[model samples]
Target: MTTNDNPATRSDRNVERAGKLDTATLSDALDKLGINGQCYKVKARSTDFRLAGRAWTIKYGPAANPPGTVGDYIDDVPEGAVIVLDNGGREDATVWGDILTEIAHRRGIAGTVINGICRDVALCLKLGYPIFSRDHWMRTGKDRVQVEATNIPVNIGEARVQPGDILRGDADGVIVIPHEHEDAVLEAAETIHHAEEAIREACRGGMRLDEARKQFKYHQLQTRGK
Candidate 1:
């Protein structure tokens, strides 16, 4: 229940808690905590896509002299972990494709968030595999890029993502909640969600919008505290 709880004990619970929250609410919580987690310009492949899980971070860079494999790390990713691929925001080549999507989906992997582009959009859509990325392109990254590292800290949408951090994505976008702050962020998000629901209920009961907002201290919900 506290932020300082052991991560091993809280990881599953935190991921479940994150699943019940939308990115907007989590983003608001991050704002209140003065954390930058909103993944700018990285959007879901389809508005229907949604996922929540611990991050399995990967960083990609230009291929070496021999040009290593583009995606040999997929097999090592654990189930229910969201693969966070940092490709330096490149759009010229894709680091993910249909094969990876099929394998990930079959393996029960939560989803994928790419700081670059992905290919084979149709397969992902068909499999109901969630993919949040800068864009989709057919161009392959085979000879252009290689996996520099795995399970390491990486940047996604200018937001630093560490291995085991919580990643929640919805129609709007993705938000990364640092593992250390998951408890606080989830608690704040729940508070915000409840407050907003209360406002909506009050409106339905004939209370003025302004009155409802004031009653819930809605305007200050996301304000950073001293």
Candidate 2:
């Protein structure tokens, strides 16, 4: 429900907007917060492409190399959006690459996270694209798989990502944070991150962990500590 209707009218994004998150920030945000309501723990890549977006998922599998490469589904991608591609755990076929990244980046797309393989690693990196895939492969999709639908429910491992759900990704992997919990998760995450930052700085300043915890109440809930 937090999905904005017009890009120009978007407000309340103080840090970085969801649609413009980079790999580091996306990862940090996920590490900072968690959706208390719902999300999925889907399959993903290690170094292929790292991405985050408002989840628009698709579930499909019937062949080794699935079709419906994400580029073909661009019409559905909103400006300043990230695309979460679910390939039903197929890891051998690659559906994303240089051309796709270029198109997406130019379209104001935030990034992409795939449940399968992605190609054009060097190209995407050069483009400063944030993409995450299960693996990289030279294989191409021949349209064997059909999108059949978009913005539909799709599962990633144990998580189900629906349209409007948040996708966060980084070197640690990707996580889908539900839209309903955005405010709570973001607020909690920000508090947790700030506390951790302070602790880290204190530790670097030669304070012992126990001493820092005693001074900052690190173990207690942030709200209570304040």
Q: Identify the leading candidate in terms of lDDT.
A: 1
What does candidate 1's lDDT look like per residue over 88-112, in tens digits?
9999999999999999999999999
User: Which candidate gets the maximum TM-score versus the true structure?
Assistant: 1
RMSD of 2: 5.5
Model 2's lDDT to the true fold?
Answer: 0.59
- Tell me the lDDT of model 2 at 212: 81
TM-score, prediction 2: 0.72
Q: What are the runs in model 1 whose C-alpha is more than 4 Å off?
A: 1-11
Backbone clash count for every predicted candidate, in the order shown: 0, 12
Candidate 1 pairs with clashing backbones: none
lDDT, residue 194, model 1: 99
What TM-score, computed on C-alpha atoms, does each candidate reach? 0.95, 0.72
